[model samples]
Target: MKDNAPVFDALDLDRHAFFFDFDGTLAEFTDDPADVALDARLGLDLMRLLRRTGGAVAILTGRHRAEILSHIDPAIPVAGLHGAEFPGEVLAHDPARRAQFSPLLPGLSALVAAFPGTLLEEKDAGFALHWRRAPQHEQAMIAAAERALTELGPDWVIQHGKFVAELRQSGGDKGSALRRFMAEPPFAGRLPVAFGDDLNDMPMLAAARELGGLAVAMGERDLPADHRLSGPRALAEWLERGLA
Candidate 1:
């Protein structure tokens, strides 16, 4: 672990831009993604954080726009689908790309059928096979992803998370999301502070630290984050202490 500082103190040094990952960061992960909900205390803490940052907060998640908004309910801009700039829909560039990826879902779904506890999830620009409930089948799940990618073409890439392997469309990531946000009003000229708990989040974390702000790892992971917190509860408590 590197030398970490109080987040509030870091924000106090200059104008700060806040970016957060949804699952495993703001909220705990659930077997069923639909079962996940934003904690009320998080809402309150976010409300306070927003007031302090002057509305420079955003959610950078792998979820779709509707799914993320329905939970967090923050009026602030969100970059979902790994920074797809979901306005009206999650896809920012081409609508047909989603359709292109849709046909591949059934194949991926079938690939996970042999594993009883695995799940096949389709996202706006991609799909995933989660094996959190079936840890023993991880290698098989990964093999399935590799086989799917061989047929899916080079337009997609495989990413890993806690017991989950995913395939998201090319061209965008959380780092690009943060960069785009940094170029906009309220966020421009401000230092960025990012938080996340997965490997895919590394780009955004590096982006934040590179921009001279801060990156925080929400859970235990070997990553570069100026600060670290045990979990969402610890994060909330830290925010409260800052406000106090």
Candidate 2:
């Protein structure tokens, strides 16, 4: 994340709804995603923003609700695994889906073993093959993911990102999550302002624009973003300043 000013000017952020992506947009990236943590200062600022927004702020993350709750307090609304609300149940838990996914797990695990530089991020609903530290192995990782997807059939899809390939449940995307939030309590009836940094967040960005709102890109990557923030530190500062 680099230092850049937000592009959307003169907009009253407090008056609109806010949705955030945690990994790259809010938290600093770590080699292991599990090692990522929210800065307490930002956490407090987030609490303030939540209050400022009339409880319309939400986190739409790939990580499960349990993981998010451990890091962020005040239990803000969240949608984990695409659009599934937290503490409810992830669609990946469906017995039939699990049965279909089980056959491909061994192959993916083998790929992880072969690519020591790559990491296998197992989730309750899906899995991700991360090669952030091993960018050179991108091609190899994609090939492995392809093989698994081919075997797993149409129920799975791969989300490509910076140094990573995520195999997830088909049709479960950020756009769906954002739409779900917009149709629900608090989030409903407000202009959605989303912030994110990767391919996974693109859908939500597009969705925000569609819903007559805005999308703030975390860094300078290609996406349907209306504004840009320098980095996670900048986001924290923006929120902290709002406390005044």
- Regions of candidate 1 where Cα sits further than 4 Å from its true position: 1-7, 87-99
Question: In candidate 1, how many Å is residue 124 off?
Answer: 2.3
What's the TM-score of every candidate structure?
0.91, 0.91
Candidate 2 C-alpha lDDT tens digits along 128-216: 89987788888999998888788778878988877778777787788888888788777788889899988889999999999999888
Off by over 4 Å in 2: 1-9, 85-92
Q: By summed lDDT, which 10 consecutive residues of candidate 2 come out lowest? A: 1-10
Counting clashing residue pairs in each candidate, in order, gives 0, 1
